[model samples]
Target chain A: SIIRILEERTEPKRDLEGKKVLVTAGPTQETIDPVRFFTNHSSGKMGYAVAEAAAKRGADVTLVSGPSQLTTPFGVKRIDVTSAQDMLDQVLIVYGEQDIVIKAAAVADYRPVQTFDSKVKKQDGNLSIEMERTTDILLTLGQRKQHQFLVGFAAETNDAVAYGKGKLERKHLDAICVNTVGKTGAGFQSDTNEVIYLNREGKEQHLPSDTKKQIAHRILDEIVEDMEADRK
Target chain B: SIIRILEERTEPKRDLEGKKVLVTAGPTQETIDPVRFFTNHSSGKMGYAVAEAAAKRGADVTLVSGPSQLTTPFGVKRIDVTSAQDMLDQVLIVYGEQDIVIKAAAVADYRPVQTFDSKVKKQDGNLSIEMERTTDILLTLGQRKQHQFLVGFAAETNDAVAYGKGKLERKHLDAICVNTVGKTGAGFQSDTNEVIYLNREGKEQHLPSDTKKQIAHRILDEIVEDMEADRK
Candidate 1:
């Protein structure tokens, strides 16, 4: 909807028409047991925003998501997953083929060393959760890139921009959006977001706090511009 | 219901009549942000089992719990809590007034050092959750004991008996129940449990796996026995 409203005010270049785009969203639930999990679920808002924006711009979008209550946006291909392993499994299935990939998911970094299929009892003093790191999805994608532009999102409470730039280079991302959360209407479940978008050449685009829908279009517009420039 | 169904063959002890008892249950939810939390809600099945059994035996029972889908058993006073801090706050309020306190809740040992009141964005790289130890509710209650008896639980995966004994000594608990979870139909969300009912003297009474309701009665039977022994 934002894309439709935005197109009327600007020339429609159809920049992303029929391009294959892959997006990831939501937080992985590391299972401790049937009912208990190790970490929080990422609300799929930001990933959904990006995916919706891409779809609106006529991209063939494949959205790999973690468990969430949010409905899939119109005209987006959605694949739901449960754990970090599940997300990874789903992601690798489509990795070699996308024109662009945006990793907006709050991928859980660690999962219990082993997930007990059933209930786990509390040992008297404390029951320990042995954690191990999950595979870095974005880094893997960057390494295996073959004509695809990769974008990643960074969320932080402090030192957002500095760390974001560091990751941009380390992950070899084409562009990265650094989101500093904690202010009203920013991060998590809120409809609005404020982000600092940066490119490989160190150009920064600071987006003011606004609804996710509006922010989505701005992010897509930048990516399209860079894509067009690279084509020339 | 177990009590009602089991009453067909035995005399009701009403052993806990007129005694003030408090029990803690469920998992503590550590808030990472407004919409996200760390860890699962302790099922509170075992705690509810104990509280309900006490009420059936005529004890003035108070049940402090974390977020759960289970309903409150009849005649038990229930106070719901969210985090470890909240559980401690609730426990302290009734600690001095109770004749017996059972620390059965699966209390979280660590919580995020800083919790954002709003949503937290995912940093592109691994987002870290800095954790710090929470207050030991059982140990604090044990230290503040005057004329009251304190019971603590130890749930462990390995060497449960050894760990339970260690905590019983460390917490100065009058009685302790060591639960061995990870077995089928045992621990969280299950209706059944198996435990070792023990005391300060190192005496242990083994309880076979049974419905939590049945186990609750067995646990209380031991407590009542110990209480009578102390009075004599």
Candidate 2:
């Protein structure tokens, strides 16, 4: 009865009752020492929003989140994670079974190759962390996608469209949301975000700045539309 | 009248009127491309909380914040910044005049040596951002401090006390707030924090987990005590 009430309120036309969705949010830390790590300013707000929106639309949602203070969305399965490797482990487990996948995590590009078990002693001179390339989770997911509608986020400070499109093509993603970070009232640490969506068919739709929750719903709407068209 | 009301609310015994305080908060961005940059997940809560507390206590507070969505604290003059160089310029401008200086911004240790004017093209293989050391803002401030009570933040995940003390000594800081980040509700995105304080005399004090606002007031209290101690 409770499930029926939730499903009914979601509206049958936009219902995703049978769909399985997987989403990733936040920043994956790259440990330098037992007490120190390299991480980016990803608040995980957008990813959680997307996950919440999908779950509300009746999709069975699995959220793989990095360390954040956000409470889990209702009716969504959550997997807490820390490092990039930790994220990969959790995501790969449920990725193959999902009908849709969205990766919004700002994964660290490089990590300290030498992870000190103890504290890294401060030297007299400039200290450097020798970094090595981390596994490209999106790229890997891109390669494995068959029936899934895969989405990725590209955070740029300049040329948002060009970079977003490039990532869309290179990663074999169904769609990509591109936004410039560090602008006033936009990106990382902000409640609102402005993003441009680029699809595999070379179509671009610019979504005006809005709360991350609103944007999340908009993105999900597009995915629903695309999935419906494909079925025909 | 409003000034008087604010003044009356802030207990006269704790008043820092006529005192000049400077605080740095948020994460400094390091440019990689015109559209991309490297940054850390520093929410600037602790720094902002400190600035807010000092301002409420009648201090003429100047908050130099990196890119963040936080609202400016009342009675505090806010200076927005983006990169490490940007932070340094602002801090240096008023360093000589400040009675207290708190370096809470998570400044990027290194920046891409070569910054692409446009979007950096994604290649078939791994992409590497060659990084070079940025200015050590804290170390420079420590060297330059004469009458100012300089404070710094050391975010560690392990050996917090030892590493924090080491940083305090090497940087010649008047005091340092050392905390282990990457733990649940501890650092970066959390509203609460647990920290250990180390002063120039090698004295150590531990602060239990509490709201950033409470912790901020505690930090200000310690700075006030030490400044008063130094006056005699």
Candidate 3:
């Protein structure tokens, strides 16, 4: 506990004071039935850190999270959601009022087309489950952006920055944070992250391997800098 | 903490002194790809309780667990596992030395036929996952059992008793514990359970809604009783 506290950014910036921020985190579960579901490897750690950092810096943070074991960060409002659709519904309800939005969640791209009422009993021979696309939360948020500073995260296995830039342009996001997954100690479920923050203005900042908490603070600093430049 | 401590069985029984007990707990995850997986709703609470109770009763316990957040009970040896196949391998390695074995983990009945090396990129159309049956750990154990008192757990939505009995007979288990899922306060992820413990000798015991810890003790008591009778 002491080491974790020490590892965290101790000096609060208060730079985001009075700002309304919303962040979505964790991996959404798509239920196949009462007993079974499909899920991904997002651990919600990075997003939780961001929410905590923002809250500590005096921003009113609302964390719309999927199923996660992490405790609620103090002073941050949290809304728990299960499926990707459920998350989108909640995020949309509060989207208009937020000054900043971060889509850090690894939402399921597909969900089972048919969810059974009861546990599907084991049948003879092989089984096949039909799945369809879930609504893209970030894309919807980007399309509807008015004054909100929207940011998206792209976790890729290869050509991370290129894919992230493509997502940034396609989703109409102000900025996108790109990170390589499948690397040891750098992605999903890890405390450390190696990220490249790229903005619409072609500004790129590479943050080397660091604690997620520290990285969150640095990312916020970049967002603040970009917002200030846009105002001028 | 005080409330939980007060609710647990306080008196320690040495009824299982020097006996070797092995328990399998939690929900096994079957990876569909690097990012996505299929899993059930088993929280491993019941199995962990059984392990804790067994250890407290002076038994040497080995807890072979799937992905669970619960901590290992005092004096219990824990072996973490992921998929159903991994669980089976770990269990079979130590099965012969165990005096009692409890199948409490909700091992996935099916697994994806193919797992991709990397994350499966989203396509324009819907996706269908082909799945095949996983080996039944309990059935395999029963077929190879020597002096071990084998027990199995059946969590079902309908005809729980009948299904559990059939499993007991078909698997050649010494006893089977059946509990109805989808109830408000019982079965998966719940601290309380309403169980029907049935043995091969046609003896039936109804354990009303109670904390998993207390129910575990009762089940052990029944096993001990039956075991003593056999000795006579």
Candidate 4:
């Protein structure tokens, strides 16, 4: 099936023998106590798939992952982090050298204002934890981004497209992939993803649902094509 | 983080306790042969998170899942399937009985025109496989839907909002989640997601980087609020 799709892909496979691709995956864990933490449901499948796809194309791939049970794809470097701050720090270390950067991790938006050394015992009374906002990784990357291509994700439930467009403008991304959460099978941990590709030029391409591997291929294909067009 | 987010949620919990919710997840595998098949990277994380969130709020949840490695969330009735046709059949069977349907699975837009029972050996240097379009599940549901709230996902790489809005109208969805690919830390398998909720009324709400679970809760909150407003 892969061979068949490869054969049918009209776009020529762009060689990335020496290109460096960096990706982030999984959900960051924000600690609330020694025994408890805050996190998301990300399984790091999409980011790992992207890394694998990049490796398949002969690119040097580095994947910075959060907490997830999935194994690393073959021929890719993996780094694990637990919090959004940690993820941001790791990304900064490699961001400068990469030719491409894809952020697929669902970093926590906020963290416990104070981490308790011990877990709070459950009592009959109610308990509360104050939260503080985490850093904006996309915006920060966009601010520091150089010649490298940057892509961002906008997961929307309502007016998905409009908000995605806003992000594209605000983040100064080369392309953005929008997924609607309102749909049952398309986003998050689903093995299949159906997405539309939006480029900086406002061109739109809709990718039908397929495996993350195939979707990753198509996404990279678009990125390579966009790069080639930029070069021209 | 779950308890913190739940406490912080602007809307009350239990709002969807009795609400009948339907969700779809994972990628439909298209068979090329008995030994090989085609699928995507969707792990069904986002949809599953939403299902779990709805269940937490006491909704009667029915999750229609495609192939995925993740375990089913507790208290959520699960139905597994492969291929787009199987998904369509399940959705049609269950959608009518539900009050809300979230189409999150990345349904395949195309499938193999022919499925060979035996593996096709690499006999010739080149082989061609015919392709055919799968059913448009969202559109079909939208057409027959009466009082049920429908949501669709627009995964775009370009013109994210315009395309998303187009999909919302085309599918007659109450709302749509738009997500862009190639971002640093959101979408697909990542646990943390950043999305904008877009409603039919053109109102957009931005959700910064957070866990898919939190995002799911926010989405459900909005949906419940919208439903409440409609009743008023």
Candidate 5:
């Protein structure tokens, strides 16, 4: 009975085996100095969860991660980088000819323009670091997206759905995941997430907060379904 | 000079110092048995990141978390939970009289109808677990939302903009964040996330991929702005 059930559940509805999937994870470090740097609260849990889920679904996966304590999931190729620029470089290099690309890394939007060879000493009261915008990886991929799926994230505290929708249009993304911060257990380095799935046809599916692995499966299922519908 | 520059950059906008903010994070475990359980890939990073950011902004925060290894940020009241129903119960107790409610926790859409107290051994060839729908936290909150700002997330893989806008209208959310999961390095456990903000008025803003902290700050700033605008 168990084998039958497993077979039924694990049976591939779509031929995802051998499909190339790429992912990016962890927080990008914007260097202020060699010792002191700017990063975020991302621990690479969500990205790793998705990578694991994809691998379980029998897809070939390449995970590009920033520095974090998370271990690489089994059967997935892993790449490590530090800054957003580094992430962008690695993504471009690996993203070629992939059927799917998941940009789950929390890349820094701005980085210190100049890197000091030595650590900047903490002087008196406070410190100010001149910052400049990093490359827009999603937009770049969107511009170059040929036959692959393009997705982005909109993490907001206010007007989340409205902002997410705007990003979907502006970046030409097939879908987007929106989350709110400044609360308790929803964002950054936690082990679960609650999100709503918004599709191009205006269908909104509200997924209750669940583990990243389950969410990843649901997300991939949706993607596969959407791709099929697109073909149809 | 650094302190001066830092001060110039840190212009005080809206103070949430004494405000009570409630948040939910992580996925609920629908137990199949004591040892075997069903869950998702939620790392609770987004919610936790938001909580840390809020605490940094001097807000008195209450974080309701599912199973996660994340350490509570300094100056935050944390509550641990497991199932969606448990999260809902905790949220109800804390949500009332709060200044803002960010439903960032990804509650499971379904739970096992009956959970086995002991681990179900693999005696048969297959096993099945019955599931039932969990509570709709956002919809319920939207219905009961009084003066508090209510925000939701829309994670869509297709028709992202349309679905996000629909959620904004249907759920009476103050705002929503939309993100796509199919892209590389954008959603879930990645350290960097790119998102879009959408308001009740349908106005949208695009935030390219960045650290969750910066995105959290921007989201909170927008929330304050929206609050002020609503008051007017």
Candidate 6:
């Protein structure tokens, strides 16, 4: 009974004790009007799992989330946002304080150039919405990096590894998790995921299909390992 | 204790016994690519409530719903659909046998002209998506109606009642429920709603702000009353 109690006590490793972590989750909405919008298929499971895992490991987690039905993880401070611009603002406000920043959110690349205050009435003809790019939040954080270990997520349909590797270098991220979407039991709304964890140092770890919770902890382990190696 | 037990046993009104009813709920999503989509702000709460209430009143209810997080109400058959076209197809499949049909879904007025099989790569400069109007499901139903008592919902930003009345006449609907969007405790994702009911004979009933469940029961009452009046 004593041995079982000890095993239970040590099962949770607080390796991230006193560390500050910021995780972003869900797909940011780009409003077309008061009632309609454009969005991706992100369900925020991966990012929420990461936030929960980080908090369990004694990290101070600040989760910047877009519109999702997920509840806030215990012991994590969550900032709720709607559009891509709103998410960027909140993330930037707390960017400097985070020791590690994981951009797991599938932020919108484009938004309608003109957003109406009232609901747009359907008319006789086809409606073409001219779109402009949202400010790249990850790129901004990468450009302004000082001591923070930055991480990014690449949800790809093709050339997954190559795209992720490119993002890691271009965004100056410490690592990027690449996951191919449009597959069964992987990516988007699925609870399970398979990802290629690629770092700036050209090291790649292939994580086979697993629940997002397990994948999140493994990703954290890699992050800690990479940070320690850099210190040496 | 005996009085409370007796009240519970006799409380439910089964006025819709053996009646066939079909209710459509939520916002239909029109896809642009593998990941991104266009959608409106219909939460399907109002529709789900209607289905639940109808089923409780002894109606054989079939709910054709778009993408929503809400659970299917007990004793109601639910068919989930994504795009506006999909919802239309599903609704029409069961339209023939229903005595009452309620079009509560916020079907997209427009969809991308071309839906890509793969994810669209982000490129330089602004991107413009050419859109086309989706098939008007209610109009089609109206044209094909036989003995069905059709009801439509109009979610408007301006002239809610006028738009609803126009839809009632144009769609040949027995009744139309109009609710203004972009308001507090009403429309879209709100659990509570206030709606104005208008019928073909120019009868109008304004239902003040109330829980969607209560509103649903009241709307059903109006539908039954109007149907009986027509019979007389």
Instruction: Specify the highest-lDDT model's number.
Output: 3
List model 6 lDDT by residue over A189-209, tens digit each.
Answer: 999988899998899999999
* DockQ-derived CAPRI band for the predicted complex in model 4: incorrect
TM-score of 1: 0.60
Off by over 4 Å in 6: A1-10, A183-186, B1-10, B183-186
Write model 4 residue lDDT over B1-232, tens digit each, in one string.
7988766675547878678999998777766553334454466888999999999888999999997877899899999998899999998998878999998897766566787643343332324444667778999999998999998776554567787888888888999887764322225677877667788888787777788888898888888877887798
Q: What is the TM-score of chain B alone in each candidate?
A: 0.94, 0.92, 0.95, 0.92, 0.90, 0.94
DockQ for all models? 0.12, 0.12, 0.63, 0.01, 0.01, 0.62
The candidate that achieves the highest DockQ relative to the unseen native structure: 3
What is the C-alpha lDDT profile of model 5 across B88-117, one tens digit per residue?
888888787888887777676656577654
Model 4 alpha-carbon drift over 4 Å, by segment: A1-232, B1-12, B183-186
Model 4: residue A150 alpha-carbon error in angstroms? 43
> What is the Cα root-mean-square deviation between model 3 and the actual structure?
2.1
Per-residue lDDT for B1-232 in model 6, tens only? 9965784587678999999999999999999988899998789999999999999999999999998999999999999999999999999999999999999999999999999878898988899999999999999999999999999999888899988988899888999999988632136888899999999999889999998988999999999999999999
Candidate number with the higher lDDT (1 or 3) = 3
Window of ten residues with lowest summed lDDT in model 6 chain A: A182-191
Q: Which portions of model 5 miss their true places by more than 4 Å?
A: A1-232, B1-14, B183-186
Residue A7, candidate 1: Cα error in Å is: 36
Q: What are the RMSD figures for all models against the true structure? A: 8.3, 6.4, 2.1, 20.7, 21.8, 3.0
True contacts kept of each: 0.18, 0.06, 0.72, 0.00, 0.00, 0.76
Model 4: residue A64 alpha-carbon error in angstroms: 19
The sequence of per-residue lDDT tens digits that candidate 2 reaches over residues B13-93 is 446788999999998887655434666668888899989988887899999999887889888999999889999999999
lDDT of 5: 0.73
lDDT of 4 by residue, A109-162 (tens): 666678764333323322444567778888899999998799887665567678
What DockQ results for candidate 2?
0.12
Candidate 3: TM-score, chain B only: 0.95
